[model samples]
Target: MLSLDYSKLLILAVVIAIVLFWPPKNKSFHRRGIDPGFLNLKVWPARIWFLLRGRNIVEQAYLQEKDAPYLLQSLNEDSLVLPPKYLPELRMLPGGKLSASEALVTSVLGQHSGVDVVLKDRQHYDIARVQLMRSLPTLVPILSAKVDSILSETLAACSTADFTHVKIKEIVSALVLRTTLLTFVGPELCENTELQWLVEEFTNIVRDMAIFLLFIPKFLRPVLWPVLPPTARMKRLHERVRRILFPKTEKNVKSSRDFPTVIDHFVATSEIVDEKEIVAKFLVLMAGALHTTKMSTSHAIIDLCASPECVDELRNEALAENLNDLPWHLDQVSCLKKLDSFLKESQRFNPPNYLSFDRIATSTFTLQDGTAIPKGTFISMAAGPMAMDPGYYEDAQTFSATRFCKTDESAVESGAEKSQWAHEFVSTESGNIHWGHGRFTCPGRWYASAVMKVVIAQILRKYEVKFPEGQRERLPNVYLDLIVEPNPKQVVRFRARE
Candidate 1:
C-alpha cells in the first residue's frame, strides 16, 4: 500500500512538471520577440542539467553579454537578464509595477514568511531605517559593549595556551544572532540563552525549509511542504517563541518609556499590534539578519585565517584607531580601512548570492532599448560574475586584502580621500550590487556593517584565530541554488592573544 501511494504521487508530480513547463505552440520565443536561446530545446535541457551540475546561470549571463539583455530560466518562469545599464530605469519603477517581493514569493514558492513586512509595511521598514540603520553611530556604544561581553562568554570554554577546535559557523552564528537580538530586541531576550537559541533554531528551520521548497514548484508546495522535516520544527519553534515573547511585547505595548530596539519602534508605530504576529515578524527579521551576517563573518574569518599577514595588518589598523577614546560609531568604524577592505575582498570573492536586483514585471514593460517583457516574466542582475569580471577590478581572480583600501599616487595628487573605498562594503556603486541598487537596497545593511566590524574587532582584540590542524586552506563555500554558505563543519582553532 505504501509503495502504491508513492508511485501515485510520483506520477502526479511528473504530470504537474510536464503541464507547468509545457511549451506553448502559438506564442513561441521568436513570435514574442524574445531571444530563442531561452526556449531552444537543447538549451532548455542543458540549463536544467546545469541545476544538477552546480553551474550558475548568472555567471553564464556575464560571460556572454556585452551590454545587451539575455534569457535565463527562473524557478517559476523564464527570466530576462539585464545588464547594469538597465538598473537606473528598472529601479525607478514603482514597486507595484516592477515588484521584487512578488518575484521572491514566486522564487521561493510563496514560503518567504514576513516578506509583506518588507514590501508592504513601509512604516516598519522606515522605523528600522531611521531608528536602527541610520542611528548606528548613536547606538554603537551600547551595541559594542554587548558584543564584547558576548564574545567573552562564547569563547570562554576554549583554553588559551592550546588551540581549541571550534566550528566557525556555529560560533559566529551565535555571536551575530545574540548581538543582533541585543541591539534589536534589548537586554531581556538577548540575555536569555533559551530565547536566543530559539531564534537561532527558528532561523535554521525556516532557512532549510525555504531552500528545500525552492526546488518545489508553486502548484505542488502545499501538498509537499507538510511532509518536510523542517516544516514541523518551524511550527514548534514559532509556538515556543510566541510563548516567550508575548509578555515582553505586551509590556512594551503598554509602556511609556521609549526603548532602543527596532521592536520598540515597531510597537509604537503599529495601530493594533497582535503579539503573536509581531513575534513572527521578529522571527523573519532575525532569520534574514542571522543567515547573511553569520555567513559573511565566517567567510571573513576564513580569509583572515588563510592569510595571517592580513590578520596582523587588520589588527594593527584596529589597534592604531585607539577606539577606546572615540565614540565607536560609523566614523570610528570607518577608520579601520584594512578591516573594511578585507571584508570587501572576501565578499567580492564569495558574495551572499549570485544574483541581485531581481524583479517581476507586473505589466508588459519595454526596456529603454525597446525589448518588451511580458507581465509575468522574472528578471535579475548578475552580481557574482560582475564582481569577478576583470574589466571591473585588476587581478579580479586573486584575493587582495587591501584591494579597495589601497590608494594610488594619482588619488593623492588629486586629493581624493583614501577612506572613500570603505563605502564599497555597503554601497552599490560601479556595478557592485551585493547590497543591491537604488531604493530597494537592504535598509539594514549599515547596522549589519557596524555589527560585523564590532564582532570581528572584539575577536581580534581578545583571541587569536587560525585554521585547525593540517587544514591550511580555507574550506570552499557551497552554492545551493542562489544561496552561498561557508563550510559548516570546518573547524577553527582559537587561543587568547598574548
Candidate 2:
C-alpha cells in the first residue's frame, strides 16, 4: 500500500511538472476569442499554472483592461463606447454589439445537455433564468429542510466532542451538494446511493473537464471531447440524475412519478425535453452554483472561527435578533446586517476564484478613458484588483466584517436598489464579465447566497468555532480558470455555544 501510494504521488508530481514546464504554445495561450486569460478559467492545474504566473497576466488584455496605448492594437473594432462609471468596459465591443448567451452556452454545455443551442440565445436565456429565479422563492420549503438536516448531520459528523478538527471544504461540499441536489434532483433520489454517487462524481468530473476545455481550442473541443472518454462516466451519472428528475423527460420517461423538481420545472417551462441533455446543462449549472456556494460557505465559517471579535458581534446579533425560528426566509436572514457584511467581505477578499469573471467581446467597445477594445477580444474586469485595492475597498486586504456595512446601509437609506454582493463588490449596477454583465448575470446567486449566509449564521449561533490547536492561519487560496477556491482543505473544530 505504501509503495502504491508513493507511486501515485510520484506520477502526480511528474504530471504537474510536465504541465508546468511543457512548452505552452503561445497560440493556445494567446488564442484570440477562445477564453480570455488561462487564469480567468475554472480549469484547475492550468489555472494554478496561470496563478503561479499571475504577474504576467495581471493586466494583460485577456484578463484585465489595459491602458490606452496598447489597448486598441490588440484586436477588432466597433465596441468603442464610453463605459458607465459603474460599469467596467468590456473588451472591444463596438458600442452596439450585443453578445448573447446562445453561442456561449452551446460552447460550454448545450451539446452536453443535448439541447438545441438556439434556445440558449438571449431571449430563451433570459426567460429560462427568470423562470429559475421565479422558482427560487419556491425553494424555501426545500432549503429550510435542507439546512436543518445538513447542519445537524455536519455537527454530528465532527471528529471530536469538544470540537472536530474538520476540513471546511469536505463538510461544506457534503452539505452543499445535499441541499442543491435535493432541489435539482428531488428528494427520493437525492439520498439514494446511486444518485449521490452520480451527482458527486459528476461534479468532480465536470470540474476536470472544464480544465481540459480551456486548453483545447474552441473549434476542436467537439473532436477532443469524445477522446477524453468522460462520456462513460457521464452516462452512468446522467442515467441516475434523469431517474431522479421526472418521467416526462425524454430519456427517463420509464419512471412514473409526476411530481416537479428543478429539472422537471425547467422541462415544463421550456422547449427542452431530452432528459440527458437536461442533465448535462443542469450539471453545468450545478458546478457553477455548488462549487462557489460550498467554497464561500467554507470561507465564511472559517472567517467566523478565525476572528473571535467578529464571531461575538454575530452572536450578539443572532441573540438580539433570534434567527432560529425564521431560519429559511430571506427577509429574516437579511436582518443580520453585520453577518451580511461579513459574508460580503469574506467573498470580496476571499473570492472563490483568484481571477474574476471574464467576457469575450462579440463586436468591440471602449473604456471610460477611451481605451478602444477590438471585437473578439476577451476582457475581464480587474476583480481581485478592484475588490482588494485600497482604492476600491477601505482597509482592503484585511477581512473587515463591516467594510460593506456602510454600503449596505447607504443603499437602504438612500432608497437605492439592493444590488447583489457580486454587484456591490465588483462596484457595478451592470453585471460583471465574471458573474456576467447585465442580462447574462447568474440567476442562482440569490439561492447560493441564501445557502451561504444561513450556514454562517447557524454555525455562529450554535457553535464556538476555531482552528484546531496550532493551525489558525486561513489556508492559502487556489485558482481554477477564473474561480477562487480555498487552499485545498483546512480543519476547524466547533464546541457548544459556550
Candidate 3:
C-alpha cells in the first residue's frame, strides 16, 4: 500500500508540473472581448490569482466592462461574465441551448464527487420546482414549529439576566439541517443523529474534495481521482448513507405518512425505483437546500445583531403579526414586509455566491451584439457587483434594513401600480438575481425565504441576541473562490427575553 501511494504521488507531481507549464489555448470567443488582466497570466497562475482574489477580479471586470460581456479565467474553467443587461435575452434561451445543470456539474467536479446525480437525473430539481413548491403552504407551519422547537431546546441554557455565548453558524446550521431533513425525510429519521452525522460528513468531504480537485485541470481529475484520500472517504460515507436511506426510501414508497415529504414526492412522481438512485436524489436535494439556507439565515442573524435598530423594528413587525402563533399561513407571513426587506438587503450584501445565472452553452450561439458564445463555454452574471452598482440602487454600498420595504410602503401609501411582491427576498428580477432568474430560477426559494423568516421571527420574539462585547460591526464574510459564506467562527450572545 505504501509503495502504491508513493507511485500515485509521483504521477500526481508529474501531472501538476505539466498543468503549470502548459500554455492554455485561447478561445476565439474570448478574443471578441476585453480579457480580464488576470486571464493574461499562465494557466495555473491565473487560476491561483482568481482563487485568491476572485471577488475583486469580478467586481473590477464588471466595472470596466459595464454592459458588455468579458472573459474570466478561474481555477477549473473559463467563464464569460455577462452583464445584467443580457439577462432578458439569455433567460429566454431553452435549456438545451444553455444548460445550468451542466455548468453546475462542471463547477463542482460532480462526476467524480459522487454527485453526478445532478447531471444524470434532474428529478430532484423537478421535485423542488414542482412538488416541494406546491407543498409549501402545508410545509411552512410544520417547519416553523420545528424551528421554534429546535431553537427553544438549543437555547434553553440562556437566561434573561445574562447572555450565553453561541457560535451562530453552528446553531443556524443545525437548525436548518434538521428542519430541512424533516421535510426531505420524515420526522423520526430527521432526528437520527447518526444519519445527520453521515449526511454532514458526506457533504463536507465532497465540498473539500471538489474545491481541491477544481485546482487540478479537468482532464487530470479522472487520472488522480482513485488515489485522492477524500474520494475514498466519500465512497465509504456514501455506502453508509445508502444503508441508512435505502430502507427508509423503500418504506416511504410503500406507505403513506401523515406529513408527506420530499422523499414521498420523489417516490410518487419519479420513475426511478432503485434504492441507490433514490438516495442520490435525496442527497442532491439536501445539498441544495441545507447550506445555502443555513448561511443566509446566519448572515441575516449577524446583520440583525450588527444593526440593533433593525432588530427592534423587525421584532415589532413580528409582534404585530403574531408570528409566534402556531399554524401560520403563507399570507400571514407575507405581511411581515419589514422582515422580508431586511432579509433581502442582507442577501444583497452577502449573497451565497458572487456569481449567479451560471450556464454552459450547448451549441455555438451569437448574441444580438455579435458576441459569440462558443459551444462548451461557461457563463455567469456578476450578481454581487450588480447589487452594489449605484445605477440600480441609490446609496448602494450602505445597508438600509428598510431599503426594499420603503418601496412597498410608498406604493401602499400612494396607491401606485407596483406589485407588492416586486422586491421581496425571493424575487428574481434582473436587479435581484440572488435567487437566479427566468424559467430556471430557484423553485425552492419561496420555501427558503419562509424558513428564514420563521427562524428569524422566532429568535426575535424569544431571545435577545448581539455580538459579543466589543464587537460592534458585522463580521466580514469568508470568500472562497466565488462562494461567499458568513463567518462560521463568529460568536453571538443570546439571552431569553423577559
Candidate that would win on TM-score: 3
129 Cα displacement, candidate 2 (Å): 4.4
**lDDT score at residue 134, model 2, on the 0-100 scale:** 67
Model 1: residues with Cα > 4 Å off, grouped in runs = 1-50, 54-56, 66-68, 74-77, 111-119, 157-160, 204-236, 248-259, 323-327, 409-424
Q: Model 2, 206: alpha-carbon shift in Å?
A: 3.5
Tell me the whole-model lDDT of each prediction, alpha carbons only: 0.70, 0.57, 0.79
Determine which window of 10 residues in candidate 3 has minimal summed lDDT.
409-418
How many clashes show up in model 3? 0
Candidate 1 TM-score, true structure as reference: 0.81
Each model's Cα RMSD: 6.4, 10.3, 6.4
lDDT of 2 by residue, 1-498 (tens): 999999999999987666555552323123222222322222343334444554345435423443212211011111121222335334333325534343333334435433333444333344336655565555654676677777777777543356766777778887888878776666666677766666667766655565566566657878877766565666667777776664545665326333356666657665757666667667656666677788778878877777878888877876666544454555665566777677777776676543333445567655566554566654444455545544344455576777656655432223223455422332333212334455455556666766666677777677778887887677777764445777666787877554
Q: Is candidate 1 or candidate 2 better by TM-score?
A: 1
Ranking by TM-score: 3, 1, 2
Model 2, C-alpha of 217: deviation from truth (Å): 6.6
lDDT tens string, model 3, 193-237?
A: 988997788778877888778666557888998888898888787
